[model samples]
Target: MKLPLSADPPAFEIRYGITEEAARRKGYEIRKRTAPPDPSPLDALLKKMSPEAVKKWGETLGGPGGKEAPNVSVTMPNGDEVGAPTTGCDAEARTALWGSVEHWLLGQRFGSDFREGLISRAEKDPAMRALNVEWSQCMAAKSFADLESPAKAMDLAASFYEKGDETTAFTREVDLAIADAQCENDTDYVRKRRILEDRYLAAGMGGYETEIAATRELNRGALVRARTLLAS
Candidate 1:
């Protein structure tokens, strides 16, 4: 099987001094952006894919017979078991490059702790809470009541898809998304949240500097190896 290689640097290797700095830059970018007029092409295509088509695409990557791919189970620090598929050329390439899929999965699971902490702290921040209240009120005015956050708005949209005609669900979801974007824009929610998030993220990263540095070093090495592999 042939695997596609990307020329761009691995996202893991692209850091801006620290997590907080990266978050600040991202927040700035978000403040300068506007919502798109329509669903992204990937989203549109995913919504249009039939079950049979999805299965066929899976088979193309996972070999013939359309059987479900094998899964590798990783037990998290919380003792929860998460299963990730170990199939397709991409998975094979990752396993070859990383040495062990289980190790990579475990790293991913634990590596998110800093981000989770940052988000948790940010959400509880006074400024972020005040912004959420304002955004919720804006959403309420748009008839999408009780939306505490953008995540909640997304959950509400996802609920429509769970038990209705897909086309109708998609339309309703789009309308809700548009309303959400409007509310967020009116409240300047993204920028405000990002500011708070960056503050918390930077503060939180102080405790994880060693881990973050180690991860970045590993990522840099992996990128070098990947480039060598691709060049050959």
Candidate 2:
């Protein structure tokens, strides 16, 4: 079981970022700016939480306090001391508090769970399975054999990273990614996946309506609170 370098694939046929010619000039101009960004109030609050508490919030450092224990303290002008959190902790706390907002929105708008369920459905889809078979055949023709699916091919590519020089591993990864993308294009894999996904979402929409409405109201309130905190 190897981990992917990137968690998701690039969008097909779209280039939204700075172009190659524009990158050099824009990059230099941005770096030359003198004014620094204003400090975020949320950042100040997290800084009052622990030592690198922001970065190592979830890590398991052995001790009586464990990893979650506050290690850093901030003192106010009024002689009050407060614990500060690391970056990781602040991010995790924020997500735990508001992550449900996107989940509900996706379920309501798409009629399916966007994160795990959609991927599960796509993998198990009959059309997707057939496409994978075709894709595997295409890969074999390209001298990349023994791969059963795009996911499997990606996993194999990731496995290379566990040994050898990082540059070598990266080169092999690029080769595999190119071949996988080419196979997907040739087999119309993306089109078929989209069609099947729509069907799956349409069939499962009834159960999400009430939850979606409730989450919408909850998210609105949460956004307001978040704005207030950030502003403060």
Candidate 3:
């Protein structure tokens, strides 16, 4: 599979410091992603296959195992070795964008650390805590009580699976998701959350300035390469 460049920024970037309207728009987009359809018969059959059986089936079908890309490894800034090998169009696309699989892997590691730090800081912020209480109350009024934060709403929805059939569980989940979105809108949850996240992110970014700059440069170069590859 070939990875396509997204017009939108990464979710972490959108959550961290985007404008209130942008944040709300992103929240709406997230809420619209409902549960997937029921699994098909083919999917059910695949679930019954052992890992060894799956591997043998793939081999019979000429899967990547027989012509795997050369394994590549790189030492991260933290001195940990990272190894990831890709095959086919995915490998080719990644090579065009990052020069090697190692570079893409390094970017992923840095991005993960960057996202984790920002999220941790925002979640613990005093202002954010106050906002969550307001949002929770809004949700409670809609009969979805005891929601700690908007993030926890999905977990609550998923819990329906333990008590009911898939169809019923999915319906309840969708209802909860709709209520969650409404509560967020009524309480200005996304706007307030974004403001707090922006404050925390601004303060935190100073510590990761070098990493951020390198990531930006990597993305800019990748965009140019992506366009060139597409044209070719």
TM-score to true structure, per model: 0.53, 0.52, 0.57
The stretch of ten residues in a row with the least summed lDDT in candidate 2 is: 1-10
The global Cα lDDT (0 to 1) of model 2 is: 0.52
The order of the candidates by lDDT, greatest first, is 3, 1, 2
Which pairs of residues collide in candidate 3?
A: none
Top-scoring candidate (TM-score)? 3
- Please give the lDDT score at residue 199 for candidate 2: 76
Give one clash count per candidate, in the order shown: 0, 17, 0
lDDT of 3 by residue, 109-188 (tens): 66655555676778888888888898789888889898898668766765777776866766676676677777777777
Which runs of model 1 end up more than 4 angstroms from their true locations? 1-113, 227-232
The per-model lDDT (C-alpha) reads: 0.61, 0.52, 0.64
Model 1's alpha-carbon lDDT is 0.61
- Total colliding residue pairs, candidate 2: 17
Q: Ten consecutive residues with minimal summed lDDT in candidate 1?
A: 9-18
For residue 136, give model 3's deviation from the true position in Å: 2.6
